[model samples]
Target chain A: MIDLLEHYAVAIMAILLGVVLAMFLVLIFFAILNRLWHNRGISRKREASESIQPLIYSYLDGSINRSDFAARLKNKHDITATWESIEIMIDNLSGEERKKLQMLLDLPPIKKHFLRKLNSRKPISLAQACVYFSKKTLTDKSIAVRLSVLQEHSYNVIAYAATLALVNTTNQGFRDMALLRFLLRKNNASMAVSDIIFKYYDISDDKEVAAEKLEFFVMNPDIPDKTRAAVIRMFPELGFYQTADTLRDLLQINVKNDPTGELTAALLGVLIDFSDQKLREIVEKHRLWESPSREVRLKVPGVYADIYGEETTRILLGLAHDPELEVRMAAQRQLLKHRPLISESRFEPDISTEWRAMKKSGDADVSNG
Target chain B: MSQKVLIIDDDPAVSNFIKYRLSKKSYQVKHVDNGIEGLDAIRDFEPDLVILDMMMPGVDGREVAEQVREHGLIDPNRIIVLSGKKMTDEIKALFDIGIHDYIQKPFSIDLLLLRIERALASLKSR
Candidate 1:
């Protein structure tokens, strides 16, 4: 029995060793193949770029006509390279040159090439095709339908790219459907979601219509608090000041009821940009400085300062004593800026010492000037 | 003699396109990729106008502009900045340092050409 067990153990060890050896060899083989593939790709891209650039420039300068340029760009191996070159030109050039390039993208061969890529099973190829389409204003309903399907792709990147492409379409129904799907996606990274929403606004021909669509998302209670907050935050930057009144009302409501504090904080942040006497009254009525949410209270100093200007000295001084470190720091930093208006004698001893120390450290001077 | 224009931009696509356009327009153009090389080109090439890209890897356009202004390598008014950055206080400060003009990127090439012509014409007048 002992001899039989020993033989079995030795056989198992040999098999395990063979498996490990096979894996190592496979790894080595793949590494070499990957390096060769990468080098070849780089060389091919370089050659394509060198050959295609002059043709593009010539086309731009009117030396080559559109048909001739499209014909030259038809090299199957260099299609990606040609598209990339055209993409760069489309991004950088405007006026007649840009129009010509945009028209070139619709030429039969180029459109067919991208259309074929759109049907690719590979995620990277599909995503690239989607991105290429996003840069163009699509009139093709069939392409939009393909993009609509891809927007639901399990891969988040391909889905996001497809959604962006759909948003670029002139079809309002397609654009709305794509955006609604994108906003409803639970797995989206916050920054990517923000960017896509911004892109939706960017590509919209009618700013007012876009604002109304954004307002719907902002006002919809079923939409995630994060998305609403992002939309609210973008309003000031996008110059949707007309939404300010609605935002103020939302802030009042959220101040009373928002559980997460994120939405309330975002409202406060945007309102600071559009702050006025009415916003100031709202701030005072809520006494937002003493809000239960620390995030909301943190925004109080900026809103107070903007609405009250030099008169914010007292509130800044009061907030300088807040329980939260960040809130106190924010208030103190603002206080330092208003140092000229502050009466040092009114400061309590501990606060006085801290203020003097902050001054001596050059923080005050930096803020004051 | 044709006017000399030096382009300091990292993007070959942009620099090459500009070079081709300017060369066709009869301007002697030289292209360099980064700020350090750009500074050297400023001295070596002594271009009548410098088309500088604001953002680059090492030694950015602002520093190059500052050095040129400090050393009087070229007239501060001869520098035109190409930036994708929106107009901010920082960009406004570039004008205070005497940059000739700021053209936002994704800019019309024709608009850029027009600006270049006007800048050079104004220089000739001065």
Candidate 2:
């Protein structure tokens, strides 16, 4: 019995030792693979960037002909890394240079490669593909498949990126609405989409689609009030003076809907860029200083400050003694800034001298505005 | 001789794009990356036109303009302003000193070229 037990113990111990050795070997093999895989990715990206930079610069320098450039792009493999390199290269460019660079993406094989990767299981691939699309203009038909997934995609960031790409791709009114429709669904990211639309007014990578298209959306009583308000609020910052009259109309409608008048106030702030006169006219139209919303009332001083005249000064002075302390202080500040030392200074040569001196000698630190 | 143009911008991409576009029209374009280098290039290149970018680190675009005006290196008519942002009230002052045109950044190369042609033509028309 003792001899049998000793043999059994030896067998069990050997089995245990063998299992430990096997695990150790497996772990080491994987560690080597992980390192090698990581190194390969890094090397591939580095090689891709190194290879693509020269062709881009050469093209930008007018050295390489377009046909040769297109041919070179077609022959280059590993387009995922190639897309990344192209994205970084063209991120800051616009105009003819940007268009030329973006044209490389229109090449058949590469566009097919990226479009195919839109369904990629890898999140990184999906995100990168969307970014390239974001920068490159896409035909409506090209983006229709991507648009379907935008509303249903489980991945919010990828969806947002894709939505931006769709918006960037086309300026057609129906297409924009389609993009907006997918964006506005009762998804968790609706508010986020609203913020994105407000902030990135021109990421369209193209010029405005006609102010009327946006104006029509804002005018449609069927759309959500918040969306219309955001649209009007964005008009001033968009540098689309074409929408100035549209904004004035929207401002009237917004104040009527939300007595708090926050949207009206915000639009009035940027409307100064289009017309100080128009801004003043809107303010006088609404009698905004008397509006119940303190935010709207506070905007009055800034608008008043924009128009220089005794009438504007008198209006500001009236507010300087108004009931709301914040409104009073803002008005006082505007009045102080425009105070003329000489009665005739508005037309005086000395006043002109001062204005010129101030305009010429900017804040010492700034290079551009 | 090719028409001489100097482009002073902090962004190499922009400068190179301008250079490439203008070179096609046979303008001899030289680019400098910053304010100091821009100042030096103006004197050295004696360009027929200077495309000045606003928003450089030190010796900023305005400062470069001021120094150029002070030195009489090139007339204000020879200068065309480019800005990454809106030309603020202060930067607009450069217009009075002879900035022939203002082209906002991210502008179309077509627009920049058009403005360049206009600026040069203004000099010719005078």
Candidate 3:
């Protein structure tokens, strides 16, 4: 037993010694690696700035065009550091100087540099490329290729950056418009594009032009699905001049394509949020569940209680027996959510005999459709 | 006797660009990179117009503009505040202080130059 105790202590000490040794090696290795990285970063930055300063100063003096200034990158040391310094300058200026910097980004050499980095298999490289594309609101076909690759990449940051780059580069400063159309219509990929618009883009620009452009793009079918839905979700934030008639027209147009109830609910919610007398009357009289999309049919019950009194509760009551389980469940959920709002004195449409007559008159067909 | 325009901004690039541009228009421009120094320049340069920035590390543009106006160091109407940090209330407050005009940063130099001429002209009329 004493011999076993001695052996166990030896075993414990061996394990402890191994852990301590491993930790010491790891600490030393990382310390050396960090110092090397730091030194290399400093020297690389120095080299990049040293090579570019003369050209930049000359450009400032109006002695050189942007193409000639950007062309100097061909002889660069540490392209990353060089790009970083140029990016800082771009961010620092505004008006014509900033516009000139943006033009430089589109120069063939710089574009080639970015395009090459955009195709790199690593996620960080892709992210950086996306960021550069966003800076000038650049729209390029080659960058689109990188976006496609990034769409399938496993990294979340790269995926997000790629989408924003696509939106920024292609959306033509109508991110609010594009995001709303695609965001609500497709009901996916909303958060990333929304974040980019709210975070990066200046919202204080000309609202009239933005509104007109937003209206045009939202009405453009060729735009991607997610982008259109994003635009739909972005309506309130766009702060455009909205009439109930426009919302009504928008609903009529949007309902045609809605494959699910989500769009109907969203459009109706928009109608409720931006309430209008004519729109409310239209909602009160119209059979909302007449939408072909089951998703739209499911949304009718949820929105019905807001438009009319308990007499119109028959609409939901009729929908309770919908053939699609999804629609019936949706009705049940709406009934519970809106139970408090139900009027104690039901409307003419709520009478038992009137309900029965309505039930027999193809009301189910309206919900099913 | 070129009209003196004192530019108060922390960004050297912006201030230098404005100074070089305004010099071509025959406005003698003096630039200081922060608010405290700007206050001193407002008193010393006796500028016909002062281009101020809203934000800085110490002695912000608002405070400097307020002090310049309140203490009678410069005509409040000769002060033109430039800021990217825009707020309607802040702009109204500057206007209430009788500052000359406001320009958002990243502004057009031509527009800024024109505004300065108008501001200085208004001062001359006064």
lDDT of each: 0.83, 0.69, 0.67
Residue-wise C-alpha lDDT for candidate 3, range B4-95, written one tens digit per residue:
99999886556666787788688888999888899888888898889998988889988998999778998888888888754779899899
Give model 1's TM-score for chain A to 2 decimal places.
0.81
Q: Which candidate is the best by DockQ?
A: 1
Worst 10 residues of 3 chain A by lDDT: A178-187
Instruction: Point out the worst 10-residue segment of candidate 2 chain A by lDDT.
Output: A358-367
Following a full C-alpha superposition, what root-mean-square deviation does model 3 have from the true structure? 13.0
The chain A TM-scores for the candidates, taken one by one, are: 0.81, 0.66, 0.48
Per-model TM-score, in order, reads 0.85, 0.61, 0.53
**Model 1, which residues run further than 4 Å from truth?**
A1-41, A187-194, A256-260, A291-295, A306-312, A322-329, A336-341, A355-364, A367-369, B70-72
Interface RMSD of 3: 3.6
Label model 2 with its docking quality class: acceptable
lDDT of 3 by residue, A1-369 (tens): 999999999999999999999999999999999999999878877877666655554575588987677656754363554456556556545677667667666767666777877888777777888778767665566566657566556676666666556656544544454343333333235676566544433543555656565566656657554565565566665544373466567677766566654545556655555644454444445566565567566656655545555545667766766779788766655554555666534645444443345444435555676
Query: Clash number for every model?
Result: 0, 3, 20
Q: lDDT by residue for model 2 over B15-118, one digit each (tens)?
A: 66568678879999999999999999998998989998888887788888888988888887798888776657856688767777777756666677888888
List pairs with backbone clashes in candidate 2. Answer: A367-B55, A368-B55, B76-B98
Position B22, candidate 3: lDDT: 85
